[model samples]
Target: MAAVRKSTNWFAIGVTAAVLVVVLIVAGVVWFANSQATSPGTLPESSAVNTETGAIAVGSGDKTVDTYIDFMCPVCNQFEQAYGPTLDQLVASDEITLNIHPISILDRASQGTEYSTRSASAAYCVAVDDAANVPAFVKALYAQQPSENTAGLDDATLASVAASVGASDAATSCISDGTYTRFVTAMTQNTPVQPGSGGIATPTIAVNGTVLSNQTDLTGDPQKDIVDRLNG
Candidate 1:
């Protein structure tokens, strides 16, 4: 009985060791893949654009507010509808600097269209060409937000959207050529993981550099919550 028990213990130890090794190998591969991801070269330059963080800056004020949004995220559209006016008012009053980070993590949901990346890249194109019109372009994109798992608006329609917002001249070519797709990917990868969350999520809001919780902090009333956060 003692001999059998000793053999069983050794077998269990060996199996556990093998599992640990496999887990370590998987972790290492994931880390390596992330490390080797594509790099964004020559960031878009504009007075209203943050070249370092890939955020489109709106309004210059004492306080800073950041929003990391995925174009294909429906919740982001809801966020925009709810808080867009409030943010605009704050910007107009010069109370807070709004940093809009256009990111793309839902490209897979776009049915091979890569709409998330394309739209984000188009926004960057607008930032490079007509910085002042970027906000309008964003609003337009959200207004025409496509359903998930559907092929999102095509390149021509994206350019048309830019034109509708008076960003046609250079933006059209930029969108058509997908000038900042890689940059969008890098920005998406760099999106800050919200507090209490393990991964990046759309419509991540940060006030004065503190990420807010959408479930607890933003559940009751987002507009009021954002204003209170800014004021507080």
Candidate 2:
């Protein structure tokens, strides 16, 4: 009888423990869901303002286009991957002047690490120090945005990436020092972005500060918008 009672007690204890665990797990899920909805702490998108240095020129054909992009954004990466080569061609041909602005509005984490923003800041620093190869540096970073929480980018990686794009140490150091924080900040907070005509998500291409592809003004493929203006 004693042994049987002991076994029964053990079973009851195990059941109680399991119930408590299930309760805790359910509560945790609720809390995490709430947190995710609130602020998952992702960095905000980059801003699209440039009252200071002015917007980038469109392809060299007397047309100027300003493009606002966030470094941490997957779509932004897709844009770079897809349209970067085409834009490079246009830039090489002097068909358009390009102003690429880094907007920072999507980098936040529970650990207070503004991942995307930091990368952007680094890239901005690169640009501030060396105005010529900003595009190349941006291409490099976007090309290798590691999965979140794996490992953050360090200065050495940035330097190597910069060097790969022909940026010298002096220029790379500027990226490390983050000298363009204010410039990048303004691009996010105070910068006034011209709306693309259609409401398509960003990686927006604007010609001479006018957004021709926003939902409102989308006449056609953004490239066509500028091409028409260029041909005219």
Winning candidate number (lDDT): 1
Candidate 1 stretches greater than 4 Å from native:
1-37, 220-223
lDDT of 2: 0.61
lDDT of 1 at 65: 89
- For candidate 1, the 10 contiguous residues with the lowest summed lDDT are 1-10
lDDT of 1 by residue, 1-232 (tens): 5665433588888999999999999999999887767668547878887766888998888898899998889999998988888889999999999999999989999999999999999999999998889889999999899999999999999999999999867889999999989888877777888778887888898989998877776764655688888777
Count of backbone clashes, every candidate in sequence: 0, 42
Candidate 2 lDDT, tens digit per residue, 16-52? 9999999999999999987655431322222322445
Q: What pairs collide in candidate 1?
A: none
Question: Which runs of model 2 end up more than 4 angstroms from their true locations?
Answer: 1-60, 109-111, 147-152, 190-201, 213-226, 229-232
TM-score for each predicted model, relative to the true structure: 0.82, 0.62
